[model samples]
Target: MCSSFRSLLPALRAFTAKCPPPQICTSLRTYATEAVPDFEHKPSHYGQPLFQSHPHLLRPHELTPGIPSEEYERRRKDLMDSLPSNSVVVLIAAPVKYMSGSIYKYRQGSDFWYLTGFEEPDSAVVLEKNASSRGYRMTLFSNGKDSAKEKWDGPRTGFDDALNFFKADDALTIKAFPAQLRSMISLYSNVYIDLPQSPRKNARSTKSLLRYLSPPVNPRSEYETVVESLSSSRRKPLAPHIAQLRAFKSVCEQQVMRMAADISGRSHAKTMRFTRPGISESALAAHFEYLCSLSGSQRLAYVPVVASGPNALIIHYTSNNQVVQDGEMILMDAGCEYNGYASDITRTYPANGSFTPPQRELYSAVLSAQKALVGLCTEAEGLSLHDLHRKSCDFLRRELKQIGFTLHTGDLERVLYPHFLSHPIGIDLHESSYSDRGESLKAGMVITVEPGIYVPPTAQFPKHFHNFGIRIEDEVLVGEKHPVVLSVSAPKEIADIEGACQGLLGLEPI
Candidate 1:
């Protein structure tokens, strides 16, 4: 054997020793004993697509589409560097969700994916700060290679490839993770973990690590269990630390987000042209999704709100079964997910090719308020989401009063504008949920500026504006001087929207 292969024999033997079953031990040993060149050239498969195999979807050295492996490494290093010495961070992957026997599409947990960039279910990673060195060590516990399982489901990264391809210092079968975590628990002074909560509704699958962690009685969480076992260590919530890191986007991340926005924006414009009187909302929603897929979106960001007429008055209305009427407005709040990033854009337009005077008046009011809120997204403005929301309420109140809808002192925020002005957007549609809305804006942050006015059919309101709802939303990236509107391709102006509906404004195919 070569010297390099000979040196790895000891660690390989140690890994094999941890295998729970004789068959698993044999499988792991076979990969470890193979020649390095043969292993490199073999037709091995991964849990997720890799650059070498899926070059059409990925560039060289990319772990995921549009994100290089080095960037994932830097994210891990940055997370560990922020923690105290002799710290250990544990992150668990999202479990595969099922509806009956069929499986829902798997999406990796955002925080876990942010750090490791390993896209597999039923896996966990531990980042141990080197007690005597400068850097940290990453250990991945993943599924062992099994021919029977591979034939049925798909290939796994397995132990040896986890070390070689994913840059993990050590790799072990997931069966050994509980024992390994217990052994390391006493050594670290600080433990940071983001544990999956105990399922309150449907129980998790037996293969899930979450099910393994969940106890039968009292239903204590994984976090609670880990905290109770620690005698001398300080336990910290891992989410806030990761959220702070995720709040600011890297240059490559910004590029991917811009691509996501463009895809969704163009899809929205196409949907606008397809809308017409007597069209069912559900059909319109399906057509929008079709356009997004044709333009390279992997999936819709969320269940789109394709509301028309009275349905538009209900915020978060997703029961898209109503047929649009000629003079009524259609409010379509939709976006797409591209390369793990999310884009959100909402536009309200007349079902017919032209808006009624009442509809145009309300649409203009919402659009003006939305523009003002987007302007405040810059770092120079130094405004928080709460501040911007207050500004939105003020802008809409004045605009509505000019349009003949007077509001009482607290009626504007309490009734008219029911939703917040902005939310951060990234890997998840609502990214960094733990982040503070009161915090000032930063240059690398991305948020949505959505403003709306929902009027009920009450005697206090003008009859022309009764039951009229109008909103305009766009994704904005905070900049040093001016905010960049990422979803600018989705037309929101009265003239442009009408032009798009009439198919005359040169709406380019995405």
Candidate 2:
């Protein structure tokens, strides 16, 4: 899809430059007609063309299956056991998103991925407690294979292979989901759905198709029927149960996460070594993600924040399009998702391969505070993010004072650090979002110990410190006694950072 679209881009630009908006659309349609004369553009269930015109959309699926079927069974059992007797749990996979002119590689819903490790999109899973003669079981509704659609979208693992590919007790076509729901809606007393994360009804198509079609008098959603069918039954959110199970990482999960962390760490190290003036923030991010992909990272864990200079003041700043100048610090908060596990590591280094006096002072402060808090990760049963977060705050307070920055707000005596010092990181970058078991930092749990001091141009700090942002983030694995730094391969010491940055130069832009 990307290659075909790229081929059309130059002509599309030419048409747009020479014509009005209406004419541009008309020319694109004509060009598309000529470009792919064989494309039938068969509409999907939602009326959009089902990616059939693209080559390699029919390519074989490639991935490292995250865990064995037994582990998936174990997870299902744990979740079912956590729920009340005779419960019904329904989880929907994330929909495949088409971004811009291309179909994005699908990312399965975290909850769905946790239970099945299935990567295909537009699939659904149902777990019923004591539904059959057996005590518990699972049924999968998958986008079963369609030879017609396979020409453009490639092969699919639908109903025919759902049982074999995803260890479901029974499998059915996703198109048959409504009928299945009708059959199973009243089977159990305790009904559950992952409603907290599912999409809302009446969602409009993004492609602007069907706007002229007459609207229905009373639009009904697939969920309304399920909810209205069970008037006398109790309904509950299944997220907490799933979250609880996901909180405690298994041996296999830890191994995947460690690999993810290591891959992400090496990407950061590469970014450090390649740092030089006149590089764009987008370039740095591309280089880092390229390194991650070179090391077998499947996709980015989240939108990377490659903020340089004052841009770092914006927490969650993902607009990595600015030019990195010499004598300025670069803050890169990025990670990659490897085999269903996620790694989030952020490192701040100098654009010129060296930090000035004020930059080093602030960077050292954040580094010290981060290390101090990481040492506190123990199996103390009751340790929560809140407790360690407070420790980070105190550490920041002292460090900021030593660094000659005045603290004023309740969070930092100022709002210099507008983000949390720590959070859980695993299958999701903020894996805690999917977890409801508890917030205790137990063994096998992976967390990030990130402490940073952002002195944007607006902050009332020393003049030299302005527009400089320094954040040292590392993935921390909760061990028997102390936290193990999984991302230690990314250097943090000032000498080490400088040494790593000064190693090479004149690399091609990503």
Candidate 3:
């Protein structure tokens, strides 16, 4: 504690407890516990002292390339070969916006990252298939340094260094895109662009990438609004093509996925040890994400679903602000994103660190079904998501029936378990590739096997399981040999989870 704080009032103690630099403020929560059941804790790391001060990104860090130049060249060549003659493809990087505070946190678009591995915002990529001239197939329009703009935005990958830094055949200011686009459109017969979906999201996506190219390009305008202005005819959707390429994982892609899975798996295990009756749902999320940040994950794949008790029955319940009860179960579905690739995993455990008999039974059903699905992970089987989902339904149904609950209606299974057994996961949490449920399993793909059973307190049947819910998810990699579980460290086995739950929580190295 700082000496200046001791002289001040106690209410302001929280503001100064970690005033000094390098003081690791590790205490999870100090607020008096509220008596509410579902919505109790609400603590985020807003005022905690800095663990370690991170200075502005040095020139060395900024100049360093994200991936090898050869890789990007290979991808562009492959995509070009697949395209018809006299065709042009355009990729727009993600847009930027001001935060409530002055801080600006930006990320590159997944598709753009896939094609170019370029991280700068307000950028566009142009790929002209079957180039008529030598050394002129690819081009980039990026933000260059303006003394006034740099004062506010910090830095830019200006045109001079753009060719070497991003390995683009040519580089120009973002302002030149409209002319470049027009010239390419006049020469090419077919044009490709990422078609907009969801008006609100679409608006933000297009504006951030194209607003810099012209005057009066408001940030709120929709993607179609911009596309209509750029070309005479409708541009075909380019995302599906990129998705096709991303669907099959390369060796480097798998390596990053494996790394992400390890970080998430270890975090789940540590969070299980941290769970107790008095701990809140938000606390668990904080702890898990804290571990992820320490482990060097760039960002979370999605919101952490720290659902406890009957709340698990509601899928995608992101309001993780509840007090975990002694006899209740905790269902957490969380993952981390690394280098634009995603790793997703889910784990269910007892709130008190040891499951009751009913919980064990429910968990066993999901576990057994997931194991059976894992067995079906071979190229010869050619099993699809629909196939795995059906198998999961059957397993849950058999388990429920054995426990003496008669699902009198055909819709009962749908009511209890609403989601599919698995979905393809890669750059996106639910990867854009293979949109259909009937898409067949293929080698070099990674997916999540999550089968859950949730019974709400309001639902009929055994009163003991009224608020009970259980789900066990794992990351699976489909290879030539078989499906490999990437997150193998997190304990899903009954005995292993129980043994871990019985010990004192390890606060550090979690």
Candidate 4:
């Protein structure tokens, strides 16, 4: 779809450049022998006839069997066990976002992905839970017009292919979602939603749904009434349950996460080797993405942070622009998603492949804090994120005091350690959890223990301390025995990182 649409764009731009807007529309309508609609009034890839051979719509079928039948059956059954009799669960995937006007790419919701494995927007899945039945009943709602969209955009899978290929019991157009809601809602007592908004309704389509459910007579009002009156009986919101499921990954999910970590780790390690005194931060950012793709990660789990020097002070710094200096540190907090699972790891290192005296001091503090926290992440009962987090702050505070950053002894101040030490990591980078505070670190849970010290651009005490930021992070999975760092193979220690810079540079000029 991307390749075909990109090809259509240049031709469309050329057509508009040579002709007036009205003339372009007339030419398009006359050639296609179709009236120009409101949507066609704007410049678009759809306006070009060169892409006629490509299909406009996408099919709701799987590329390959993503989840095995047994796995699907198992998850479906598990959901059934938790639901009440005559329960109906509505799951919708997230719609795509436009980069600017008329260009779109979307990330699917986890729940919707788990159930349907469909990526098409404006799609919804319905699961009927029954006490007597062994496997839950399933239905899918998708786009109707296949060939209609194919001429302008791309090919669609259509209902027949989606039902048979994806093993959906029944499939219908998105229009059917509203039409079928009357019966689907009346029959089932419970409706499950992770959030209030319907997945089938995008930013453009939701207003109509709200109007449909509004008090005034709209013939579709009854359908909305049924859904609204029974809205309180939603299926169990998987706040902690889904977190639990994701915490203890299946073999497949773990493999994907491990692959993501390896790719992301290599990206950071490569940056360490390739970075020099004059390289623009943007080039390094592009190089990091190239390495991520080369390592088999089709998508980055999140935006790559390539902050150099003082830019590292900004937590979510995405604009990789500043020129890295000889002695400044670069903090890169980036990761990739393998399959659908995510891996988030951060490493702060010198741009010149050597840490300065003050840089080494801060780096050692953060590393020591991480090491101390990891020791506490044992299988010991009753230890929670809150407990481990305090331990991290305490360690950091002690190290800082010893190094003369803070005058206070063991008591850490929030002005120093503001953010918490850890967060759950999985399909979502900052994955959903029960609470940010007091959440227990359970076995099978995966988290990132990142401790850092950021000294903003200032001139009070040490001049070298100003405009320098350092953070060391690793993904750790809680085991029955001990904490296992998924990113352990990556160069992290001061010695190991220097070794990687030398050895990796020896092979090729990455």
- Give the best candidate by TM-score: 1
Q: CA shift at 78, candidate 1, in angstroms?
A: 1.1
Model 2 over residues 1-510: C-alpha lDDT tens digits?
Answer: 135644675787577587653311121112232344453433322211122332212112222333556687778887787778878887777755678979888777888888877766666778889745445788987667777877787667656456654568898876666557667857778878744322447553221111111121112354345445644436666777777778778776776677777778777877887778898999888899888886667799999999988888777899899998888788889989987888888888888888788788888888889888889887763577777877888888898888677766653635677777777877888876554324567887778888787775654667777777778888887877867787876777887677568763222223
- RMSD to native for every prediction? 14.8, 13.3, 12.0, 13.8
Worst 10 residues of 1 by lDDT: 23-32
Q: Kindly report which residue stretches of model 1 are placed more than 4 angstroms away from their true locations once superposed.
A: 1-44, 131-134, 201-233, 508-510
Judged by lDDT against the true structure, how good is candidate 2?
A: 0.70
Against the hidden true structure, what lDDT does model 1 obtain? 0.80
Candidate that would win on lDDT: 1
RMSD of 2: 13.3
lDDT of 3 by residue, 198-244 (tens): 35744534433355433423333443354555445645667777777
List the pairs of residues colliding in candidate 1: none
Clashing pairs in 3: none
* lDDT for each residue of candidate 1 in 73-142, tens digit (9 for 90 to 100): 8888888889988799988878777798988888888998998888877788989988534369899977
lDDT of 4 by residue, 275-323 (tens): 7888998888888788877665657888878888888777679988789
Q: Is candidate 3 or candidate 4 better by TM-score?
A: 3
Report the Cα lDDT for residue 147, model 3: 66
Candidates ranked by lDDT: 1, 2, 3, 4
